[model samples]
Target chain A: MNALDLDRQLCFALYSASRAMTASYKDLLAELGITYPQYLVMLVLWEEGSNDEGVTVKRLGERLQLDSGTLSPLLSRLESLSFVTRHRSAEDSRRVLVRATAEGAAAKERAECVPARIGERTNLDPASMPELLETLRALTRNLRAEPAPVESPDPPAAPLNSHRASALTARH
Target chain B: MNALDLDRQLCFALYSASRAMTASYKDLLAELGITYPQYLVMLVLWEEGSNDEGVTVKRLGERLQLDSGTLSPLLSRLESLSFVTRHRSAEDSRRVLVRATAEGAAAKERAECVPARIGERTNLDPASMPELLETLRALTRNLRAEPAPVESPDPPAAPLNSHRASALTARH
Candidate 1:
């Protein structure tokens, strides 16, 4: 009942599963010569097919919950791969829009079967997917909506490994 | 319901939630001067508290599902921070053992409240935490257990964008 049992923490579970999910995409993504995150950007752009204005970089970041620091480099790589193109929006010089290149858009059809392959790998019930998705969304929303909880002010805190370990697993 | 719809993909959902969970840990982890992944390593070591014979690098890799390329640099950083020490095992020179320094072990007490803080942030019912953990574990297990599925060879497939877009949302 150790409080920090790696298996018991939701954070570890999420982290582990997320990494595993990424790993699962390795070979699949390789087919399209894009990394998983790159594929995600393409997904958004492909969904917006033929929107000449494409998606604003800001909108892409918002959709993916990525900051420009991360998104900018990723977009650049996608651009280098010819999977996507980024241009300053005509109406807003300050804004950049990301659209899939012909090559990138063509990858989508090949990508269509990607999810089904992943679905089979997870062995998750399609019927249950909706509920699972909802739970994850709720988890994300709740985590994002709140501030980090405050720690108690106390002297007996540090080095309580053995002592506090009892309390960590005691409740959960 | 575009298969490429960012909102609809389970992979994106997991990716977003995982990143959010990591973000939620920012302040909490900053207090410990460790990154999210580094904290995870500490969690494992702390759980093995006072074991003179600490965990092997191989075992740590297995436990964390991280390769040596990633784990080695991380361990080096932790060692440099004086939070951990690594040495070659007696019986197996090839096997390295990692143990926490007094500083790292003591940090565990302060970290005890971390999970509780995160749990509060998730706002998940304590009663249902176990189920969520199980689902995540199952997902990781399944994703890791399989090889990537094979794609069929057919020229009719490459440009199924507009044609297949109809089916992606239709099913899901």
Candidate 2:
């Protein structure tokens, strides 16, 4: 079958591509002693910085689209690694706030080189990254519109038609 | 940050979207007693028909961009479930051929409704399916262009633009 006929479901492509990308990151993350998802949590914390009000598990889950069943154990693993500390919030005892430690923040410097390493490996131009990011965010929004119980609220809106442009500006 | 920011890596969005999509599938596949990857294998064999020449493990790996490490265990699980069979070829003892059984062929009839069900959950339109699939395949090729040892002499060429379309269209 030719391309037109073989166009498998978008789901399959998403599935395979995601796994392939994760596989590429395996060796890199091994050096950091974290899995891909753990690295993502570190990224969120790094971008927000440690002094900013730490993020809650629910908030992190909402952004990452991961449920507690996965996040809880993952958080514990990171905590065991001393990259993050999770504690019950005083004002809201039910809420758990996750904060990165000094060591965790230090990992960012090492990680800054990571994206470039991956970019080099993939041979995708750094200039074209925003376009790719926009497409992915669009796909994520379209796929994630359905709300689940216990899910965190969506992030504040990016400017209309601003996804690619905003990402591009950030790089510079 | 504008579109160019390295902070806005497409990798995160793609990775998260993929995980979210699979999470959506996990619940759906639970009813069918199959996982997401298993469903893809079923689709391939179903489209090819029960008596069709068995798909080789290497070909499956090539199509899925999976290594023997993952595919071997997964295929074994499928065999245990009686959905497929793996046998060594007499002509080429080193080659293993994977063929679906009658049960596996019949499973497709049960699965015909899965695409629509998943679409309902994700709110993705079938018309948009081609574009999403194309983008994924492009990303996969971009990522796969990196060097890796050839697993077999007859490695399937990157399907890229045409493979998915032909395989999928022939079914409809």
Candidate 3:
């Protein structure tokens, strides 16, 4: 198989694996009433202490690599669920601060089991996990340092060329 | 310093990198009027010749690890763009087949440059590329092997736990 073959490409493998990991989380998160992204947001809040000034949407976007469009709606959903609250920064009106409520803080206890569950799902040995993290971080760093080559002509468009005849057969 | 550190997690690294890669693609894909997921769907169809009945939504979702909710909307958007068509199978009404249009096939000529562009963005030397890919593939594989643990309810969800806080600091 060629290097660019879907199965051969590490990017595809990582991409597929990531998708699968997210899928695995679907059921677990469903009970929490949140999607993967939402769960990630919640995770961030849980770690940081939701009652604090909270994290900013911009900061959240930076960490998550999501833009305002995705993050805004997601935050709204969390707010509606009462998992978080959106507050305007006193110093910077342009910035939004997201703090967790009592209920949100309470949710943390429910989420404690999540990491272990995820660990089990991945079946990743604790020892090798660090190396794997390093590799992914390196790749992500490299990708982020480079500029995007293609620009969309339209604003917020969809996919272009697609066919049904071929399926992405996994080639080892 | 600890394994539980968010920065130390291969999953978070992979997740972050994937989001970064896709975010970078937004401008490029938008210029082409396609989203990142749409581009992937196109990759499967275009590379496969989109000439056959196209790919089934279920098959596409299975390979992509996406459910019907995500796939249905994405396919519908593709259909609106005239890139693909979605129809029910005569034998199985529950099944939906996606086929590309002539225009969709032609779009490939324009997109042939995507891989190279994305590769350049990664800044990985040709020699390092394979190793990087292999490591990511391994990590991703490990993550997909087992069922992820579910979220357990107990104490309230904390936005930032001590472990995660330290991890975040370490990440910076």
Candidate 4:
């Protein structure tokens, strides 16, 4: 078997599909003056019904599986766009909270058309969406559950590229 | 129904799954000093059996669905690593071609271990992989077929934020 074949790799499949999906979202989002990741944050804030209290940076990070380094800049961009507001928590001065501005929340209504539009493009049976979602969610959960293996402290005697030659030679 | 709900979106599911899957590959790939996308390029070169003639940048772009803006920098980095060689095609000076180096070709042996390791992490039934791939491929095809709606040339009468107020007022 050609183990090196790209078509055989599930990771490649997911990676390609994800990028395609994001591309579909890109132009739609550009009209809203936001990126896909920014839209994701908006979804979270809209769903949480964030008000004056707002969602904390830490909580937003946990929900989005993003670190502060990523979320901070994103939030700042959203703030500059007048789509969101970020302020230090009154109860806890050290904690920062994020809330969608009125425009950000209103952007939701315009966004209402997004999913159906994307759905039409996919030509996927609406009936099958749940099944696909289930499979993908399970895959995500399983993959994220375990940590990747750490590199070996010691180096291999043969250089990395030699492995390809040895394997190919064996195959021939 | 909350159309804006993040959980209800298939795009979000695919987006999350893709990131998690890539994360699973990170440490495994780090040992080889390559990123996931770089590994993808290697997989293609190995499969094509690229020789001195090599694959053109344009051909590589089509296969990977990446534009030159993205591929150029990536190819340069790979060249710096000595995993791949990039040169102007003899027949066409205007066209640059990319081919795997001896080390890059040999790196395939080390990469042979990646799929099985990812499989173990996903814990997906081997029988189910083909089915999932088919579904994802279809999704990608469908999403890529349509162009996003162009933004309005004129500005709205109300501020973008007021759209939220109108939407919320209509809901109440």
Best by TM-score: 1
Q: Which tens-of-lDDT digit does each residue in A1-172 have in candidate 1?
A: 6778898889988999999999999998998898998888887788764766689988888778888999999999999998888889889899998888889888989999888888877876565566567678878877787763464454222221121122211221
lDDT of 3 by residue, A39-117 (tens): 8887777666434978999888876777899999999999999988999999999999998888878876776666677
| Tens-digit lDDT track of model 4 for B35-138 | 98898888888877555568888987787888899899999999999999998978889999899999998899899988887887786656556656766777
Instruction: Show model 4 residue runs off by greater than 4 Å.
Output: A148-172, B148-172
The predicted structure with the larger DockQ, 1 or 4, is: 1
Score candidate 2 by lDDT. Answer: 0.69
List ranges where model 3 is wrong by over 4 Å: A1-4, A30-33, A49-51, A148-172, B1-4, B30-32, B49-54, B85-97, B128-145, B148-172
Per-candidate iRMS values, in order, are 11.9, 6.7, 12.3, 14.1
What's the C-alpha lDDT at position B134 in model 1? Answer: 67
The C-alpha local distance difference test score for the whole of candidate 3 amounts to 0.66
B1-172, model 3: which lDDT tens digit per residue?
2333456555577688777677666666776688878877777776563457767887777666678899888989999999988888888888887887887777777776666766666654454454445545554555555442434444222222122112211221
lDDT of 4 at B149: 45
Better of 2 and 3 by TM-score: 2
Q: How well does candidate 1 reproduce the true complex, by DockQ?
A: 0.34
Q: Report the lDDT tens digits of candidate 1 across residue range B9-62.
A: 788889888999999999998999999999989988887646768888788888
Decide which is better by DockQ, 2 or 3. 2
Candidate with the greatest DockQ versus the true structure: 1
lDDT of 2 by residue, A42-157 (tens): 87777664575788999888767778999999999999999999989999999999999988887877787777656655554455455456656665665555533333465224
Candidate 4 residue-wise lDDT at B172: 18
